[model samples]
Target: MELHVVSHPLVDHKLTVLRDKNTPSATFRELVTEIVMLEAYEATRDILVEDKPIETPVAPMVGKQLAAPRPIIVPILRAGLGMLDGMAKMIPTAEVGFLGMKRDEETLNIITYANRLPDNLSGRHVFLVDPMLATGGTMIDAIHYLAERGAREITCIDILAAPEGLKRLEQEVDPSINFKVVVAAVDDHLNEKAYIVPGLGDAGDRLYGVVD
Candidate 1:
């Protein structure tokens, strides 16, 4: 697994606001969309494209277009839903899918309660979006779920990640599965309660308010 941290003055500026507990849900939602759009630029650098012959107003020319078997964007439910619009706007032609997964606070184990994706994702590129990578259990399980269905290449987009989570991903995931993680920042570590420290707290709560 490869990791890419996007470093930009704009990203840093927005992230600071996102980290503030005082930021309202409306503003937080908007910031999440903006940051994801910026990160999508770097995450899709190697996306498959093919040259297409086209006739310009003055002359015939060749331009590039996304290749066949359009990529699929899968957001890991709840918090992940906050990132869907930004990613969809970046690649309007890409297909969309959903995977509902939640981490058991006590066990840190991932529980997949919903799945709405193609039965066969053979050779199709997948982009998995989630706001945070805390313990990495949810992500690791999500990757395995995709791989089981024949997805070989996947790109994971996250707003923040913890070193412990990233390390867990590296040590636990299959070597054969090709995947990369793109994030705005990598925080210091996961606190005892398994939350990224100095990180934006409970992305879902920030974006949609707390749930009982």
Candidate 2:
């Protein structure tokens, strides 16, 4: 798995606030979107583009546009949905998919509650958006699911990551797959409860208030 941790002043600024425990839901949600846009810019650095010939008001010029087998954006439910608008704004034409998965608190196993994706992702470039990559069970499941569907390449966008989850991708998962992770920050170790230390708390709860 390829790993890229974005380094930008703006990203640093927003993440600092995001890490604050007192940050409100409304602000946290807004910062997630803002920070994602910056990270997405780096995540798509190698995105395929083709030359386009066009005439400007002054003269003719060649431009670039995203090539076909248009990219797909798969947001991993609830919290991930917070990042959809920001990513879609970057690639407006990119198709959207949804994966609703939850992890068991006790066993840390993943459960797939919903899925809305193309049957044949053969040759498709998929972008899976999730805010935090802690234990990585959910991400591992998502990667296998997309890989089985023939997704040629997958780029996971996360706001934060932990060493444990990143290692899981390296040791437990197939290393040859065309997969990469772009995150705003990779924080300290995970606590006993499996939460990323110094993380922005539960992303889903932070983005959308705590639930029963």
Candidate 3:
């Protein structure tokens, strides 16, 4: 499990705005997009590319192109939907998929009611986008589900993560899985309700207002 924290000055600036309770939903949504776009730069650093022959005006030359089996971006629904545009902008050719996963508030377990991804992800790289990694249940279940469908490589992108959640994922996840986590920041710990402390509150609510 490779972990990367994007440490750019601009990432820090936008994250500060996001953490402020007064920042409106409209601003919060846009900032999340921009900040994730910056995170995408580091998240896709080693994307595979192949050299292809090309003609540049007068001479024949070889240029690199993203390899076949283009990566797929899967956003865990609703809140994750808010993150789609930014990641799409970063990898325009990447296919988009949807995974609707919600956490049971009482049990802190994940429920998946919808999935629109390819049946076989044998050689495809998957990027799972969700704004927060709190208790890690949502992500852990999501990863296991994708891997069950043959997704050999998976990367999870989050705006903020709680150390408790990250540690839980590290300790309990399937050891054979090839996975990585990328985030703007990892907060101190999880609160009683499983929310990240000092983290942006209810990312979905902050972005799209409350949903029943």
lDDT of 2 by residue, 1-212 (tens): 78999999999999999899998989988888899899988999988888999999999999999988999999998889999988998999999999999888999999999999999999888999999899999999999999999998999999999999999988776766799999999999999999999887889988877789
lDDT of 1 by residue, 102-165 (tens): 9988887789999999999998899999999999999999999999999858999999999999
Candidate 2 has what TM-score?
Answer: 0.97
Number of clashes found in candidate 3: 0
Candidate 3 lDDT by residue in tens digits, 80-113: 9999999999999999999999998998888999
In model 1, residue pairs whose N, Cα or C atoms come closer than 3 Å (at least 3 residues apart or on different chains), thus clashing, are none
TM-score, per-candidate, Cα-based: 0.98, 0.97, 0.97
Better of 1 and 2 by lDDT: 1
RMSD of each: 0.8, 0.9, 1.0
Candidate 1, run of 10 with poorest lDDT:
103-112
Clashes of 2: 0
Model 3, global lDDT: 0.92
- Once fitted onto the true fold, the runs of candidate 3 whose alpha carbons sit more than 4 angstroms away are none
